[model samples]
Target chain A: MAQIEIRDLGIDYRKPKSNEVFSAVDSVDLSVEKGEFVTIVGSSGCGKSTLLMAVAGLVDLTRGSIEIDGKRVDGPGPDRAVVFQEASLLPWRSVRGNVKFGLEMQRWSGGDLNERAMQMIRLVGLGRFSDYHPHQLSGGMRQRVNIARALAVDPEVLLMDEPFGALDAQTREIMGTELLRIWERAKKTALFVTHDIDEAIFLADKIVVMGRNPGHIKEVIKVDLPRPRNESILDSDAFHELRKRLRAHLAEDMSSMQLVQEVA
Target chain B: MIAEFFYRRQALVLGTLSMIGIVVFWQIAVDTGFINPFFISTPSQVAAEFKVQFEDGSVATNVAATLYCFVWSLGLAALVGTILGMLAGWFADVESALEPFIWFKYSAPTVAFYPLFVAGLGYGTPTIIAIAFLFALTPIYANTLSGIKNTDRDLARAARSFGARPLDIFLRVALPGSVPVMMAGLRLGVGRALTGVVVAELFGANAGLGYAITYYGQLMQTTKMMVSIVIVIALGVLLTQILSFLETRTDSWRVDSGR
Candidate 1:
């Protein structure tokens, strides 16, 4: 049985200024095995983040259902944790306090909550900054704190929505590498969303590509890359081949979107 | 050696010197008959009056009366304003219902309602406190409403994703996020409440700094009246300074770098 099962899921949002309700995601089906790392990649408005949010139970599903361990997902639960794009650390809290927030919410009484939060902070390589507030840290450091906060609760599944999207290219790459290391040690099922192709390929056991205009999954490619992948793989031939295939898939969607624009 | 010390503490030194210079100039002017002491009074005469008032305990009695009204009115205003503001911010219906009335009370001359309060509560401490409460309530309510309404959406969303219940989200995310602005509201309320107390005392109160000012003025005791005036100004500065210190303490997170 899959650890996470999302079948024929759909989501719709009403326009802010208009009464029209439009589908943000539709008929999306995916299965994530235990401890598997899956990445979802698409352009902005492709509903990739929406799909991730549905799995995290933050968004209400309009059609079908999402199940974890064969149980239906209705709302946010302690079994899952999410890392938002903006880091979203509370400005009033220090790194350790922000990390402890999830545990505090869950009413976690399993031994010492402070110790658990401190462990996660150190895991994210921010031990020295445990007492630093959000504003005292750089953008990349803030996102690391966000990741630490999510992981502190010891959730079964980790969901990320462009966790490093706001970071510079160099910092983003470093974070990706650090995330994989953490994922290996933590050994939890992770579903990451990103627009960076190399990021998606480097970190996933499978890559799900989505298209916009009533979003649907276009393809799911199984990555043949070996474990403990490094930056050097990005320069390899096989990595380039996979990148080319993914680029073609995205380019087709872009041109189709342009054609739709022209028609309108 | 002294240059660096003076440069570092320039504002304190300059402010103190400027104040002393003004008092000295005023004393010289009064002594030389350039300004009539009967009308304006000399700095030394005012100081002598302050000593007499302090020794005889009149200053203590009047200050206590004014402070009694100020504290009660400000406390009730803060409590009532915060509760109503939170309700209005959370519920659209509550906001819509309260909007017009709040604006009316905020913009209208609150002093105009003093006669009605005096008639209802009967011209004493109760009436004085009521008038001051009404004056201080609006800014606190307004700031809290805007603060809650403008809480960072991203923080709330993050808390929701962490499985925080609605109550948890409100208390932990929304309330804490709104505190800086709420403190600002409290600061404004302090100033307004002080003004309200003085104004109310001017009209109806029998024992307060404001009443003393009026009494001494009618008796043509300029030096005694100046004592009350100086106390009122000092109280305003002291209260606002304390609130500003607290505001900055709560604001440590928003400020970058310099702890």
Candidate 2:
């Protein structure tokens, strides 16, 4: 059975005086099986992040409900953990304290929160900076802590919004592989949002392609590729084909957008 | 290091030069008999009177009394105002309810209504201190509320997503964010308190520097009056400068506009 359900999800973004009343995520229906990684790929401003936030109960849905385990999600709960693009670690908190923050919120007692925090910090390979504050670490290390903090809750669903999109090409590749390794160990149902086609192909068990300007799901492609995926997978025929397909689909949209803008 | 020292030295030199010029003209006016010696004494004569006053211990007692009022009033005002300000900032109802009453207290010329405070708190240094306390509280309360309200919402949201509880967010984030603005209010409050103390003493006190100057002037003791006036001016300037220095030191992260 699917862990989440997004049905007839039409979102209208109404700002004060602007005449644009376009639906950001238009009548989108998507679901996640118990332990699957689903990636939503689109151009910038295509409401991919909006869709993920809706599922995490961060973004208010204009006309739909997102359900988790037969229960409707009305607000953000500890059951779903989200990692944002910029790795929003609380500036004053040490990495260790940040991981423990969520657990402490649920009133988890005594030394248990400490042990769990330490365990997760070690898992993310940020044990060295456990005592260090967020401002002390580099961007990549901060995002790792963000991932660790989310996982510390032992959440049923993990929502990642461009978690590695800020990194350089090499660092991005390394973190992506590391993310999968951690996800495999933790084994949580995940919904990831990204603008990169190759990234969506590399990390996802299923990839949902999004179209811009009142964003709607253009295609949902099943990856069907074997995992415990490594660097060599990028050179494989199956990997190349999936990448090419998503890339071609996005490229056509980009050209059409340019043409339309020029005409208008 | 040498350049920084030179810069400070130049600033001292420029300021001292102007003060010396003013004193020189005043002395010349008295020495040349342009102003009667009985009405306007020279700086040298005031220095001589200061030595006599110091030996008699009247100057020491008066200085001590004035300092006492300045400190006592300022301390209570800061303590009370901060508590009220934090309450006002945190709760909307408290802010709206207390705002108009506070505005009336702040806007009123405190000197015009000195009799009320005198009637309530009574005479000597205590009355002076109460005046300073009332004078200093408003700006601190208002600025503290403004500072807390103006804190960056983005930074707050980031902290919220990390699962920090309400109290933790306030203590760790909100308070630190408010430090730069709070320092501004504190500087103004301390200055206003010192001014209030002097005004109170001038109006009603029996044993302060303000009382000594007025008492001496009325008796035509021009040298003694000059000395007392110098001390009063110095006391106000010294207190303001010290508080400002401490303000910059405590919250040095703000951009130094030097205004």
Reported per model, the fraction of native interface contacts reproduced equals 0.77, 0.08
Model 1: pairs clashing at backbone N, Cα or C within 3 Å? none
Q: lDDT tens digits, residues B1-259, model 1?
A: 7899889999988999999999999999989989999998988888898999999999999999999999999999999999999988777789999999887896789888888987788987998899889889998999999888887888888988888888998899889988988999999999999999998898877899988988888999999999999999999999999999999889889854268
lDDT of 2 by residue, B140-175 (tens): 888788877676675455455545567866776677
Estimated TM-score for each candidate: 0.94, 0.76
CAPRI verdict (incorrect, acceptable, medium, high) for model 2? incorrect
Interface RMSD in Å per candidate, to 1 decimal? Answer: 1.2, 4.5
- Candidate 1 residue lDDT tens string, A1-264: 999988999899988999799999999898999999999999878999999889888889999899998889998888899999764888999999999998988899887988999999999999999999898899899999999998888889999999999999999999989999999999999999999999999999999999998899999999989889779899989899989999998998888777666557
The candidate that achieves the highest TM-score relative to the unseen native structure: 1
Residue-by-residue lDDT tens digits, candidate 2, A33-91: 98999999988768898888777666678897788998898766777888877646655
Top DockQ hit:
1
- Tell me how candidate 1 scores on lDDT: 0.91
Evaluate model 1 with DockQ and give the value: 0.69
Q: What is the number of residue pairs that collide in model 2?
A: 0
Scored by CA lDDT, what does every candidate get? 0.91, 0.81
